[model samples]
Target: MIIELDMSSDTPIYVQLRNQIVKGIGKGEIQPGEKLPTVRQLAADAGVNTMTVNKTYQILKNEGYIRTDRRLGAFVSENINMNAEFRDKLESELELLSAEASITGMNREDFLKLCDEVYSKMKSSPIQIST
Candidate 1:
């Protein structure tokens, strides 16, 4: 998976890493149970400090998005369920964003079109449905 970062942005490096991992999971770029690159490796790839990668990994581990074994390194969490409660929570959270986007000049039609595009792309990709 390719991770692009904006050095000029106010967001922290660890935050960028965490968001990328989340999007990667949602987009199927990183499969469930998939082995993630080592912290040192990802840091080297991103040209960032290893501590930053370690911190991002720690956050992801806490979020149940990744797991690390003593020697196995980090792997994507398997069977991550977006349960009904979680779904409703996400919907509620996104409604705020949708409202903001609307106020910021994104029309409902355009917003939904973008959603459809993303859904199509995600559907075309190999799916890892967690029951």
Candidate 2:
């Protein structure tokens, strides 16, 4: 949907673009089967090169977040596959985050509350456009 890329950030442009698209899907802003903007269009709108957009789309496609066809271009995938590898990686990251939170004196309840708040925000973000 609506994407705002921070050019000054240390994160690569392609990664930021990919992450925003994933967030859009998770928030239901970009529904299943919805077509995304063409790479040239998105690149122009975001003030980035087409190659960057292509890289972002490729990553999304590989991760099962989107699909592409020669004639139809790219659309949101009907199903997202969160396989065992993804689950394991998520668990490991969560463990590290939880450890950091604990070290910073974040109690179990507070940490959970924070998670809920962030999740709620992500789900509620407005879906402005299909791009």
Candidate 3:
């Protein structure tokens, strides 16, 4: 998928890259077993350093989102491990978001409807990996 990084953002580039790749997987833009660009190639494409891309890859690997190989580069993990910790984190984030929505005058139905719309849009979009 196409990843656009905001250089001025306080977040590190590697973190941004890692997050985007995760989102891509969530949206089905990056399919299981799909090969990712080599660290050098992605660095050049994103105009960042190879180390930055490598760091991102390492983080993805640790999170069970992707795997790396000496010869094959990185590939999306066919099976993501959704452990209890992951569920706890997901619930925590959702709770925070729900609270924010409630504070903003969004009813439960409206919030759920918005979530469905966004989820559908993400699922329908085609994945475009940059060379």
Query: TM-scores, in order shown?
Result: 0.79, 0.87, 0.84
> Which window of ten consecutive residues has the lowest lDDT sum in model 1?
122-131
Q: Which candidate tops TM-score?
A: 2
The per-prediction tally of clashing pairs is 0, 0, 0
Q: Cα lDDT of all candidates, in order?
A: 0.85, 0.88, 0.89
Any idea what lDDT model 3 has? 0.89
Candidate 3, residues 1-29, lDDT tens digits: the string is 89999999999999999999999998888
Q: Could you give the C-alpha RMSD of every candidate to the true structure, in order shown?
A: 3.1, 5.7, 6.0
Question: Model 1, which residues run further than 4 Å from truth?
Answer: 83-89, 123-131
Comparing 2 and 3 by TM-score, which wins?
2
Q: Candidate 1 lDDT, tens digit per residue, 3-78?
A: 9988889999899989999889878899889999999899999999999999999988876789999798999987
Residue-level lDDT of model 2, residues 30-118, one tens digit each, is 98899999999999999999999999999999877899998989999886766776778779999999999999999999999998988
